[model samples]
Target: NNPKKTGPTLNETFLGLLYPTENYKVYGYLTNTKVKFILVTTDLDVRDADVRNFFRRFHSAYVDAVSNPFHVPGKKITSRTFAERVSTIVKSFGLSTAV
Candidate 1:
């Protein structure tokens, strides 16, 4: 007999954790074999500078922060870990943005 495998896709897990409050508007579709894309729209207006900074910081966080192996699946995300990662990104980018 084969053991049952259970879990959500990475996209689902990402969105579930990213939009727990349902405050974000995401419009995009991703298949298991294709690259995932997420488009976010919020009520609060985002300035060009803020958007640029966010991307820079996000890239930094993705690189210098999250463990590469854990980025795959079934990994628990913690607030403190997230905060630290964001902080690292901000510092690396020389931004004063609070994460």
Candidate 2:
């Protein structure tokens, strides 16, 4: 009944831990600064290289977001520009924006 609880609990394990559930694959990337990026995909054939590329592009967007003069570090991202950039990047990979 609590399927949502599993993801966060597994995420606490560590960076780079790929946790596979019955219908999805959860991938993780942790920066040296401890910023966690989690990617959940239903495509079983998704390759690690593609995941790495996605994270790289996402990281670039994240950097640009944080570099803004008005941006506050460690706070939730509320920038529309950053969201649009990330959505575009994700769409380029033929992935849906729902996630």
Query: Per-prediction TM-score, please?
Result: 0.33, 0.72
lDDT string for model 1 (1-99, tens) is 335755544444122223323464443434333434354655334343444455545544444434555555435445466678767654554334477
lDDT at position 93, candidate 1: 41
lDDT of each: 0.46, 0.76
Tell me the alpha-carbon RMSD of every candidate. Answer: 13.1, 10.7
lDDT of the structure predicted as candidate 2: 0.76
Across 12-60, the per-residue lDDT of candidate 2 in tens digits comes to 3234437988788888877656788898888777767677778878888
User: Which candidate wins on TM-score?
Assistant: 2
- What total of clashing residue pairs does each candidate reach? 0, 0
Error of 2 at 95 (Å): 7.0
Estimate the lDDT of model 1: 0.46
Off by over 4 Å in 2: 1-17, 94-99
Give lDDT: candidate 1, residue 51: 40
